[model samples]
Target chain A: MIADYGYVGLFLVFGIIFVAGALAVSWFLRPRAPSPEKNSCYECGEVIKGGSWIQFNVRYYLIALIFVVFDVEILFLIPWAVIFRELGFVAFVEMVVFIGVLIAGLVYAWKKGALEWQ
Target chain B: MIIPVLTLIIMLIVGAVVLGFIAVSAMFLIWWERKVSAHIQTRYGPMRVGWHGALQSVADVIKLLLKENITPSGVDRLSWWLAPFFAVVPVVMVFVCIPFGNIFGIELIARDLNIGILYIMALTSICVLGIFMAGWGSNNKYSLLGGMRSAAQIVSYEIPLVLAMVTAVMFAGSLSMQKIVEAQKGLWFVFQPNMAIAFAIFIIAGTAEVNRTPFDIPEAESELVAGFHTEYSGMKFAMFFLGEYTNMFVISALAATLFLGGWSGPFLPPVIWFLIKTYGLVTFMMWIRWTLPRVRVDQLMGFAWKVLTPVSFANLIVAGWILMK
Candidate 1:
């Protein structure tokens, strides 16, 4: 079974080599002249602003935190969903309860306006 | 213990063939997109190169090869250098499990792992990391914003995407892509009412995942100047382009296999059927891209959480209850 994943690994190696080979081939063919101005980062021809690695939006973090909760819910659901039939109807009700709890969490978040981007 | 040498050789051959397809298909899709978008815009694009400019992508590739590879100063050298490879490699890894149809004595899949669908989903999300690296490593404001928007968008849309996948897993009762395709043999999942909803959700979320129009807030060219790839040049930029088309193919192939009875039709060979369905979906996506304007970041993220996620969840429960009954 573990050997099955080896094909995936093999493909990854092939993909890496493909990109590297293309880049290497182009390296030989492509021009290499670069001035300081040519090497400068593009910013729509306006001289450089302050550093770009400044503080980001709080909303990105907010969305990420919310994503974590749902992502884990999905992780739990996959196993349950797969085996829910053999586990019987009781398992079905249990999932409803589980999803209900998550939906309630979503409602709570909605009430708090955490979903709002602005 | 020893692994069979024949199996290794066969896989190597298949890998090379897949690599060839990647190169050929990217060229085809570049030409196709140009023709499609041109017709939509009332213009004849690239007609002079070869029959309707079919060889236009070939010419473009030569140009790209001869173009300059400019590495800007002050960039994070390693990340900037490696980002294009990161963008591409994972998309290639997915083809191994995609069941292309049986030929000779074997299923044309490279290897049909038991966890194929899950594996594809997980590998695809890695693409955002590459984009984010391109943005951050470039040390440019627009690239950084593009990367950040992409990270936020993928994270939000992934919920509906995964949940929609769960719906398929529930119905198919397996994670293997081939088995999922086989399960749909008698009844294509899209034919069922609940599954039709799942298919809709899957395509919408998938469009977002690949960063196509209407969901293309991350790479909005008019706003972000080619977004995360602002600083990449020449062949490095070409790798990103190839990855986008290949990733589009991956998602469409999954949609075909999962919902459209993959590689299984009455008359024609299975691989041919598979190609038809997959390309049909790809063409549909390109049509949507040309027709719709890019959505704003607020609308893109909000639609994922509010509309798609909740509807898919409700649909999942309904499907589950019906399955129980």
Candidate 2:
């Protein structure tokens, strides 16, 4: 196990070195050329406009909120599903309850207009 | 003295073969992507050169090599160029854990580590960081946005991806790829009722992780115009291209090794079976890429966090309870 992790670590180091080396080589080999027009933000060659970093919609946050609820539920379900045959009726009952909780969240999202698109 | 020299020679030859395979496979996959996409859209793809454009990628490579390397002013020169190398190296490293055949057979794998799954997972994460660097270093706003999107997408999807794998690990009771493959000798994990759910989650998460279609908001060509690598040109761009294709191969191979019974089949060599299964998965990925419309960013995150996460978690609990009993 230790050796396995070590190999992964070695690979990471190699990755860093390779990337760093390439950048260094390119910096030296490539010619340096800078102009205001060249450095300007590219937007179909139109003249420069306002800042490009405005805040996006809040719906994205709502979607993330809904996702959190569901994602956790899925994590809880995988192991249960794996051993379902062995666990019998009792396990099934527990899973039903779990799914019930998830369904409630989905229903809640659906009702709250969270799932609707403009 | 002879034995040591012979061992050294063998090691060099093996390394060369592996590197050669990585390069050739990546090139072929690039060509295949263009051809497949062309056919899907009702157009002829690269039929001019080397029998139905087999050498088209080769021609493209030469062009990229001959093209002048451009460096934009005010960009972080070092990081801008380093990005591509960072993207490709981890992909090459992932092949080490893949078991192509049995011990008595070719066993084309580079290394078999006990924590193979985790190792690949960790290495793949570095690719994200590379993109991040590329975006920020390029001094371009579009590239920065693309990089940020990639980072967010990767972070969100990675959780479910790992969770899905946990289900397999819990069932197989091992983290080693070879051990995982061996566990499926009698029955592949995909056929298991509970494992089926996990497998589905894995496929979806894998697609997002590699930034492939519908989930490809990071590099949305229509929107970002090539995303984080927008400023790159020539051979540097090719490296990123190679990296992306290699990543696709890694994810497909991983899916095969984990759920489809890696290197286990009758009437064929294990390596051939493994490749066939892997390529099959790859082709499916390509199909999805061409068929589905690119999803909006909000929808992408919603699917990951809301749908996939909850389903995978529920699957996990069910797996745990079953194991307990």
Fnat of all models, as shown: 0.82, 0.13
TM-score of each: 0.97, 0.81
Give me candidate 1's TM-score against the actual structure. Answer: 0.97
RMSD of each: 1.4, 4.8
Alpha-carbon runs more than 4 Å astray in model 1: B1-3
Which prediction has the highest DockQ against the true structure?
1
Write candidate 1's Cα lDDT for B1-325 as tens digits. 2467877887789899999998898889889999999999999989999899999999999999999999988899889988998899999998889899986656788888988888887888899889989999999999999999998998888888888889999999999898999898898999999999999999999999989998988889999999999998899999999999999999899999888999999888899899999989999999999999988887888899889988999999999998887
Number of backbone collisions per candidate: 0, 39
For residues B1-325, write the lDDT of model 2, one tens digit per residue. 9976775566555555665777788899989988999999999888998999999988987776665566666578788867887788888778668787654556666668866776777677778877888887877777888987887788778777877787788778776788889999999999988888988888899999999997999899998988998888766887788889888888888889888998899998888899999888988999999999999987887776668766876787777666667
lDDT of each: 0.90, 0.77
Deviation in Å, model 2, residue B111 alpha carbon: 1.6
Best by lDDT: 1
Model 2 global lDDT (CA atoms, 0 to 1): 0.77
